[model samples]
Target chain A: MSAPVVELVGLTRTFPGPPPVHALDGVDLVVRAGEYVSVVGPSGSGKSTLLHVLGLLDRPTGGDYLLDGVPTSTTSERHRARLRGGRIGFVFQQFHLLPHRSVLDNVLLATLYSGVPRAERVDRARAALERVGLDHRVDAAPTTLSGGERQRVAVARAVVTGPSLLLADEPTGNLDSVSSAAVMDLFDELHASGLTLVVITHDPVVSARAQRRVRISDGLLAEL
Target chain B: MRRRAAPVALEDVLELAEAETPPPPPPPRRRRWWGRPWRRGDGFDLRDLLAEGVASVGARPGRLALTMLGTVLGIASLVVTVGLAQTAAGQVGRQFDAVAATQVVVRPGSVLTQSGEERATGRLPWDAEERVERLAGVEDAGALAAVDLGGAPVTAVPVNDPSAPAAVSPPVVAASPGLLDAVRGRVVTGRSFDAGHDARADRVVVLGARAAERLGVGRVDRQPTVFLGEVPYTVIGVVDGVQRRTDLLDAVLVPLGTARADLGLAAPEELQVRIEVGAGPLVARQAPVALDPGSDDAFDVEAPPERSRAREAVQADLNATFLALGAVALLVGGLGIANVTLLSVLERRGEIGLRRAVGATRRQVAGQFLVESVVLGLLGGVVGASLGVLVVVGVSVVQAWTPVLDLPTAFGSALLGGLIGLVAGAYPAVKAATVEPITALRGGV
Candidate 1:
């Protein structure tokens, strides 16, 4: 119903070897604006490779990826980086946060490369942290926070740039049940407010929270 | 759609909606044949780059200090060695100036006779001292000659002991009053014969210190007398420190007029002129012409080489030896910086990868590391320069020599550290720029 934020057509990724391995094979998918999509797959099911291609971190061998109406498959590295910084947000399972920096500083780092204005970066980072329900802990270091709090800080960093699409790779794989539900509730609130999200996970319960689910296996995808 | 039961804040929704709308894209332009389309404000601001660099460099203080030690020692040693060389050379030059650099000797030119025998061509004027002293930079000038007593057996005692073993006779020398000053010799006892004695042709002599000792004359207060070929001369004084013409110490010196009147002496053979240091060549050239204006080559003059030339030669030698040592230390310092920077790159691969993922261009990533190393080098340079100055001053103070340090050289050495850092950081910065975001994020090589 809405404008497509992510479009994948005939996406293929093959690693060069004595016998080449195709990690992504003829994958086709569309994530519309304001949609919450979950990609479910088992180990060695090409999930990581697909996520990488979708995140614009890896180049697809043969395909067209249209991010926000821009054909990005043929774009230069600089242009892709610009798009990745200003248009896309990523959340990895490890919650890559600088342990030495404060929560506010970690969130502010995302704005540094995303073309955020110098005068407004701090205010924007604070606002993003508040939205994640961690306004009281903006000055705390990541190492001092629990696993769930660190994940929340990572989320704040991801959304600080107001990316058009948010990509999460196993956002709750390391979290307890209580924290997982809380993170899912936060995602639901974000999706209800018209933010597009694509979450990759292996858990059935996690995938069930999304409006649309796609299972990936052997380098191909089937909608469920 | 599966809706969540939790309520969402209206402001949160509004903020998300507002942020979701991306900044307006630039108007499309004609595609260039080479390179990508130019984007406005694409890279980092200089202020932000510097801030990030400082933060990262300050993150590990212990490692930073350890890495800077090599550069510190390199620059400090370079400055110290060069400074000490200059200071020590100055000390040696001063001693040289006092003696060798200040003295000039002139002698009558020799001519070949019909029989192929060498004979003196021209004689020095009787008033050679007065004539040469008028020249600028001439401190003292005098005339002297070895007098032939015609087989005279000179003795301190009136009678010669012919029955005893034959004793060697001390030669007699006739010198003008200015000779003592020219030779830079000081009288050890009583007084030297003055111009009055020369004018009156007085039979007075200043014995050399060793000659006085040989003659058993301890003090001139008793008015000791020595006989030169049956002529008696009063021992007015004894000279000890003969800086130039050291042979004067053993000779019995008498008044020039007295030698000509009593001993039938001819014109003086040689003239000794003590010029100011650094004025050797000027005085040497003018002294020969001043002695005999009729002929430029009337006298052969020997002056020490130019003071600056000798000083420069010594300085050059010192520079060559010390600079090699400094260069080796500097090279080691550069290698240390490179090795540490490379190790830092490898250790922080994840951080570099994350920076790349955050839309940092390869150049920006490299710039950060470059700035870090340059700052390290600059800091080391400052510290090393200060230390070098302190050591040079300390050594100079201890050795009681004047410390000579070129300020520009010290400042330039500090900047050289920055240059070394630049060269040392190049490879590591390139390596850091090459890190791929995907592999880095996946925690692979």
Candidate 2:
């Protein structure tokens, strides 16, 4: 791939404190098209911060990061959010679905800032849920769903946008072994279908499953 | 080989692209702004939320009813108060306009006089008022002197027949042209006293129509004369009828000179003083019509009209007391509306947060909430005004009074309701505007 999907150079992030916590330190990384990369780190190793920055949820303290061959350091917050919505999909371990809404509604909320038409929302939501094999539970309240099923619903919400990148943050952290394997298989299938997938996890199994693994400790990525 | 060879190149490529990855369906057919104005197209769609919002409220009608009830009662009270006060003001204006300040009265003393008791004081004669006119700044003056018909019951002998109606003692008042504009009884049957009649001491008298009927008189155009203690006084004109204002009827009107001659008195009949240009009377005379010495209840030598106004003032005080109580209800209602609006702001914080997160500015949120509150208050005003009218009708029906509603009363009360809304909603709306979106979305009060 002549133009990498992601490129980060000399990334440094520091928090204000008595002893300023260095969340990220001079990290350099790259991923080409259709690559499945997993990042692993111990506690306080800046795993989530790295994921949030990649997902455009937070402004970087210092970095030269390019997305789709375009420099992201100069991008405005609004542009970042649009790019995040249109070009990158997110999967969080906690699901974070609104409990008051139905499964259909929770998935539809992901599409709110994307400017979808109001008329076709219901049908579209139903179709998204069907893809995750929960079409029968379209109107079921989110609090009623099983853990694995809820994670699948979250996955459905993420992939409904058909973005070029899939950013999963500890995707299987809340699942048991069997459910974890099932989700991993789904990730494998998506990768085979040519999505650029990034999974942030400490799971050795997930690390082994990805075609590439990037390990970090104390805010620096180790060359392996 | 299996597929038809027709358009094979284009068809196969299109199918392959679709199988690999689908394009984004041309950005979801960009909807017209009115059709889908909001950018977040997937919001609880109007249909979903409208039904759901209503359902959310309907799920507990008891609470909803209580909320709405507070608004309803507040509005009703305001409307009723405004309407009743309007009616009272209207009736008083009409009555005042019909028989306005006609003449001035002068007694032996000033209003605050500590002289001899009012009953012993003398009434200014008809000629005395004419004398005052000669003083600088004095204008045309007349006298319409009166004595109580209810006091010292006297003998009455009918002019046409002595035994007619057995007996009737009408309230006798001696008046001249000055009283014409003051009484509802205008001369309809005969002509008024011209200068010739007064100078000649013609004794031509104008009878009130009711008194004329009582005396069995012919059409007064011929100008007949009747005996006052067997002293014949000519009939000059007859008025339609005198007003029965608080049981005082102006039944007999005679020129001052004629009355003086008839009574054989050196002093003139009661005097009426007039200032040059509508200035209220400076001095007045009152002979306590019904009082002895050392009494606070002594009747005054005030102009009959002035005394009537005093009576009106007392009635007005009573009216004001009721009106003030009504206003209190309105004020309480206004406060209730404000309180409810505040509670609504707090309760709907989540909804406000959601709207803000979707790009609503703080002003828009405040404006929407305020508009809702005002609309609520104004609706209450309309109802309250109606209740006010109802109150007027009830009072009049029960007391035989013609209470009324007027333009200013209506306008004032309606505006008062709006003012209440503005006053009450101000702080709450500010509080709502100060709310932070992120904090509200976090749902921590």
Calculate DockQ per candidate and list them: 0.21, 0.10
Per-residue error (Å), model 2, residue B349: 12
Q: Judge candidate 1 against the unseen true structure and give its global Cα lDDT, from 0 to 1.
A: 0.85
What interface RMSD does each of the candidate structures achieve? 10.8, 9.9
Which regions in candidate 2 have their CA more than 4 angstroms from the true location?
A117-123, A177-182, B1-173, B176-252, B255-445
Error of 1 at B344 (Å): 1.6
lDDT of 1 by residue, A110-131 (tens): 7778787777778878887887
**For candidate 1, lDDT tens digit of each residue in B352-435?**
767766677788889989988887788778888889999999999999889998899799899988888888999999999998
- Alpha-carbon TM-score of each model against the true structure: 0.83, 0.53
Alpha-carbon lDDT of model 2: 0.61
| Model 2: per-residue Cα lDDT at residue B281 | 36
Candidate 1 residue A6 C-alpha distance from true site, Å = 2.2
Give the per-residue lDDT digits (tens) of candidate 2, residues B1-445: 5456767977989899889996664322222111122344443333443343343334344554554444455545544554555555556655664444434444343244466543333444444444555544335455565533334322223256656564555555555555543334456777777546655667667766766666767586565665454556677777765442322233656665665555444443344444333234333322222112233232234432443464457457656676676667766776786787788788767656544433344664565556555555655565565665677678778867776556666556656666676677777778787776444543522
* Candidate 1 CAPRI assessment class: incorrect
Error of 1 at B21 (Å): 36
- Candidate 1 versus truth, CA RMSD in Å, comes to 8.6
